[model samples]
Target: MDWEPHARRLADTVLRRRESRWWNVLASTPRHVFVPAWWEHGTSGPVARNGPDDPAAWLKTAYQDTTLITRMGTRHADHTTPGTLLPSGPWPTSSSTLPTLLVTMYRHAMLGPDSHTLVTTGTGYGTALACRRLRDPSLVTSIDIDPYLVTAATERLDAIGLHPRTAACDITTNLPGEFDRIVSTVSVRPLPASWLHGLRPGGRLVTTIAGTGLLLVADKADDGTANGYITADQASFMRTRHGDDYDTASPPPSVWDAADGDGDTVTTSRYPLLDVQNTWDIRSMLELQAPGIEHRFHRSTDGPRTAWMAHPDGSWARAAAPDRRTSPLVHQGGPRRLWDTLETIRDRLNRTGQLPVHGAQATITPDGQTTLRRGRWSATL
Candidate 1:
């Protein structure tokens, strides 16, 4: 079947939302080509899907403006290519971040026709959007830590009749050159000093600051410091992958045995354990501040629901309810109280009418450590 109509429909969704002038990039960019083989999690290894073979399903998902994790567990989908189902571990390696989120990021970067840009490439989706917006292959440089992803994105962009300089390099260690703007699709722990140094004076950089609840949109100062505001928005892309994604596992027996079952009281939650992927506010905030925390919610046939949030940092929370409309009795334990953090932020939002993000001051150290200070509360990640 022809795919253009489906692409148009997806573009229509984006346009209706007034998200991006570059929405056609989503329609024109052949997502399936870049993501021919991808992994999805199940009980065992990730289930693999073939774009050419599963054209209908592929077209449908590709057009929906949703993020698709193209790699999972330990496997890099680009390297493994199309074959059969691959083993999935416990972490996502790469993804096509949802179209709207991609648009928001680019829009936030404030790229203009004169801008020289550097972007991180995972699935090449965001790079495609950048090329579409700037329309100058020479102005955009896309880099990836994984040589395999860089290679694949290079070929796919070529196939689509778009070309930007693509490189296999570590962005955290060194940026290829000074840029008028830098936008990263990956979550990073801080605004790399290299990025600040590599930015032309007065150039702006937009990226999700890793391991925290923040996004930084900053301009380089004369002294090489980039200062900007923390956006009220939150986003979390997979952290730039290294050789592998998953870390050594903690003993499951100890995890369960140590789980607090005491005042970890069980009660009803005011909201359903939100499938954050479907919720805009919380998901964006979570992405900006605390990406990679996984959520598990159990709902019974009788409407009883229990939700658990777990993070790699040894944090976990259990919140449950007998029905859909009550506040949950929450139980939390770990090095840090994960739920407490969430609730604390939520409370700040409730009382102050907003969380401290927009207009928050961002100071990027030469070492790449970023500290976002909002009034009396300051956070670093």
Candidate 2:
């Protein structure tokens, strides 16, 4: 598919100067073999990005490091072979994650040569990298909720003379074995106690705590409570889905009402093109502290930009400004000013050059409240 040149550039640009362990894994693995076909979201629905009807543009996207929506709205794109095109659907059910972020999460996973690793497999790209780095099938067990995905991953990994124990298992429930490291590409709202139960003492676990945050890395403790730090990066994968996949959560009626308010404050922000989704320090901290909020940003072709933040708890914020450089006019209602919280965090980062997400102390309680403390600021997610 002529993807090697692009893959090599990605390795040099993204992985170069990163942790050697993660860099080696990213450079060694062949990504294209694992994702032969994928799905893309369109205005009307989810469309196949492979096969005879698929355009060269579609193939380029499918092979890139970017996430490709492979299924949505009652259809699975992976089942579409090399000569058929499936219509695009409403939401993304699955995807191959960004290559850079995948490596970033792995860097935090702290997997060593001898470490037994448990990873959630999707397109099997990540699992392939794990196999290449660990080079020991018995030390790595990759699981996925879909049996078809597991079977496909097994075959693909085998093609490269790499094999790991593959299983169609739900990670939110019991895992198959105790391991030295556990990393999940899927997001879960609460930290699973089964993860803690499956780890040997002093083992490490890296995952995105469902509902609000970034990658969390911690070592298993003697008392059963693990302690570690949040990574200085942020990413969101599709939420773990069961049965017929994720049903939309009930919306809070008061959010729309709050968006229609005039009592909220209006001001310009210092940063333009917030790119909150791309900010490692800010996003990781926010996810850990307030994972319930979903973010939305809109920029018109003419340049008027508006951003919104909504929480399931009836809290919401909307900010609009004429240009990226102008301070946003913010309207917030319910419990707090969401943008204000973010700006406060930005100001902290401005003063310190970075938030303390990387070195912060994390204490996982028996109830799944992860408390992170850095200097005078402390938060629970």
Candidate 3:
């Protein structure tokens, strides 16, 4: 069955419910061709999905407007045999980001006909779209830290009658070349100085901050600096890696389990129990306030809301609510009160009636010193 039409419809809805200039490119390009096989997120672990074995299901997943897990830990789906039971512990190392999110990032760049863009390479699906949009593959240069990914993506692009400059390099350490627009699907901690050096004056950069949904869309200035604001659209991406996997291993339950107990301060919270992962505004604020706080949530069989948060600094919080009508029982431990900080933020939001992060001013210096200021409060990236 032809899946191009189905893919096009999904792409339109993702691009603000309007017909995008890149619509035709998205329509014609066959995404399944690039990702013949992939890993699907399964309850037990990463499950392998084969293309030739189940062509129909493959088309359905390939055309869907969702991310397809392509790698788990350092094991790639392409390398895994079909129907194999893969270990689930390691976090997803790579994926073909939902087509919609790719459209959003492209739109954020506000690309011009003659624009030259430096982009990140994952499955090369986004790279293909960029090539199709510009109609000149040479105008686009893509990079990935994995040599295998770079080689496979290049070969796949060639198979589809499209070719662009692709490289295997650590983007944070050094960029491939100067470009008018620098867009990264991977998240970074502090804005990389190498990125600023690679972006031409009067150009734009769109990316997310590591551990947060904050999207930094900035443009280069004549004075060797870049400034912009956080987009209201909260976006998340895997942190950039210098090697096959993330440098910092996932935290064990022991680090956070200690915080789930009766804490130094045990009291009723003013608000209902909330899962930070589900709340964009408050989640982004908390991540900005305290970066690297792992968030999680659980529900009892009878339906009590329970939320937990833990950080590397030994800060942890747990909140539980018996029902919607009752306030949440709060517990916090460690050097900082995790729940209390969240409540303070929620309190500020209650009194101030707004989140300053949306459309807040963002400034990045040449040396990569970045800051975000909104009203009286300010924070460094």
The prediction achieving the highest TM-score against the true structure is 3
- TM-scores, in order shown? 0.81, 0.80, 0.95
Off by over 4 Å in 2: 1-14, 17-28, 41-46, 51-63, 80-89, 211-213, 250-278, 287-289, 301-303, 334-354
What does candidate 3 score in Cα RMSD to the true structure? Answer: 1.8
Candidate 1 vs candidate 2: the lDDT winner is 2
Candidate 1 C-alpha lDDT tens digits along 1-381:
477788677777776743556766667766666677676555656776667777887788777778887877556654465655655336776788887777778888998998999998888878988898898878999998877788888988898888999998877878888899999888777566788789898898888765444566888888877778877676666666456554553334344444446434333343445444444445445645665666666677768777667766666777777766656777776676667666655666667876555667988876777777778967665
lDDT of 3: 0.85
| lDDT tens digits by residue: candidate 2, 36-94 | 67765556544565633544554456446677655564456766654344443245666
Candidate achieving the largest lDDT: 3
Instruction: Tell me how far the alpha carbon of residue 16 in candidate 1 is from the true structure, in angstroms, after superposition.
Output: 3.0
lDDT score, residue 179, model 2?
91
Summarize candidate 3's per-residue lDDT along 120-183 as a digit string, tens digits: 8889999999999988999889899989889999999998888899999998987888999998
lDDT of each: 0.72, 0.73, 0.85
Model 1, position 43: C-alpha lDDT score:
63
